[model samples]
Target chain A: MREIQVEYFAALREHAGCGRERLRTAARTPRELFAELSRRHGFPELGPLKVAVNDEFGDWEAPLADGDSVVFIPPVAGG
Target chain B: MKPFAFSAEPLQPASLRRSLADPRCGAFVSFEGWVRNHNDGREVRALEYEAYEQLGLKEGARIVQEAIERFGVDHAACVHRVGALALGDLAVWVGVSSAHRDAAFAACRYIIDEVKHRVPIWKKEHYADGDSGWVNCERCASHAQPPPARQAGR
Candidate 1:
C-alpha cells in the first residue's frame, strides 16, 4: 500500500525520538494514521497531537494521500 | 486566494510591504508587540519563549481567516519572533489593510486578540538572579493582559 511520510519537530520531535518517519497502512484519515503509526513506533505517550496536512491545520478526518506530509503538533506554551 | 500571512520572525514593515498589494486598500493598521521590562513586579531580565511551532502557525492562520470573515479586509498579516529576547525587543506584529479605515482597524484588533488567546505559544520569565518561571496562563486573563515578559533594566 502507498504510505505517507510523517515528520515531528520541536517538542514533538524530542518526544518522538526520531526526526522523520513514514507510515504504511490502510488507514485513510490523519487521526487513524497517526494512531497506527504511534503504535508501530511504540510511542504510547504520544498524546492527542494537532495534525497538520499539506501545510494546513485540520482534523483527523482529513483524508491522506501518498506523500502527504503529516506533522504532529503538541500543545506548547510560548509567548 | 488568502488575505493573510503568518510568520515567527521579527515583524518588519519594509519586508512585509509586498503583502499590501490591493490598490483598494487605503488604510493600513499595524501592531507592534515589544518585550517589556517587567511582569507582576518580577522585573523580568529576559524571556525564553517556546511554541508548538506547527500548531501556532495553524492557529494564527485560523485567526486571520476569522478576521477576514468577520471584517471585510483586503489583507492581514501576523508575524511573531521566536527564540530568546531581552527587554524592549520586538516580539510580535500584526497588520491589516482594507478599503476603509474602519474595517482595517477592527480586523487588526480582532486578529491580535484572537491570536493571543489561541496561539499555542508559551513564555518563561527570567530574573536577574538566575531564576526563571513560565508565565502561567491563569496569571493573566488574556494574551494582551499578560504583563510584558521583559522589563527595562539591566
Candidate 2:
C-alpha cells in the first residue's frame, strides 16, 4: 500500500466534498486508484478525463509511488 | 515577457499588444474570449475559473511555443483570466505577430484551440436559479440542445 495526495477541482471538488486529501490505497495504477476513490466518494460521471501525477500529465496505467500527488482533470472549456 | 500566463486581475489587452510590437512584423492578429450572459439557454450570472497551477503553466507555455513554430509567427502570447468574472468580462486573450497576416491569423486560432483541448483549466458557471454546473462536466450522454427561441408574437 502507498499513501498519496489527491486534488480535485470544479465538479470533482463538489463531489469529493474537499479540495485535497490524503489517502492510503493498494491500487498499483492511477486508473485503479481513481476507480477506488470514485466508488467511495460517489463522484459524478467523468467524461473524457485526464490524469496527472506529480504535476505532470500521466497515463491511466502509470504506477503509483509513495507520497505522489494525483489530479483528475475534466474536459476543459477554456478559450 | 513570458509567452503565456494567467492573471486573476483584469486582462490588459493593450499592454499585451504593445509587448508584441515589432517593426519587422507587418501583421498582428488577436482573439479575445469574453464571458457571455447566457449558455445553452440558461441565464448565466457569473463564472469562476480554476487551474492546476503546476501543470497548467507548463502546458500553456508549450502551446504558445507550438503556435509560434507551427505557424511561423514571430511571436505569440496568451493570457487567461481566473477567479470570478462577470458578464462581458474578458476571459482570455491571444496575440500573435508575424511577417504576414496569414501566419498571424492562423497562429491565433491554433493557440486557443490547443489550449481548450490540452490545458487543465476548468470553468464553473453560476445560473440565475441559484445553481451552477461545470462547463464540460455534469452532463449525460444525452445532451439536449436548448429549445428554439419563441417569436415575439407567438
Candidate with top DockQ is 2
DockQ of each: 0.09, 0.26
Over 4 Å off in model 1, which ranges? A1-79, B1-9, B137-154
Model 2, B1-154: lDDT tens per residue? Answer: 7888999999999999999999999999999999999999999999999988788889999999999989899999999999999999999999999999999999999999998888889999999999998898767333222112231100
Can you tell me which runs of candidate 2 are displaced by over 4 Å?
Answer: B140-154
How much is the lDDT of residue B28 in candidate 1?
88
Candidate 2 achieves a global lDDT of: 0.85
For this target, which candidate reaches the highest lDDT against the unseen true structure? 2
Global lDDT scores for all candidate models: 0.66, 0.85
Candidate 1, position B94, lDDT = 81
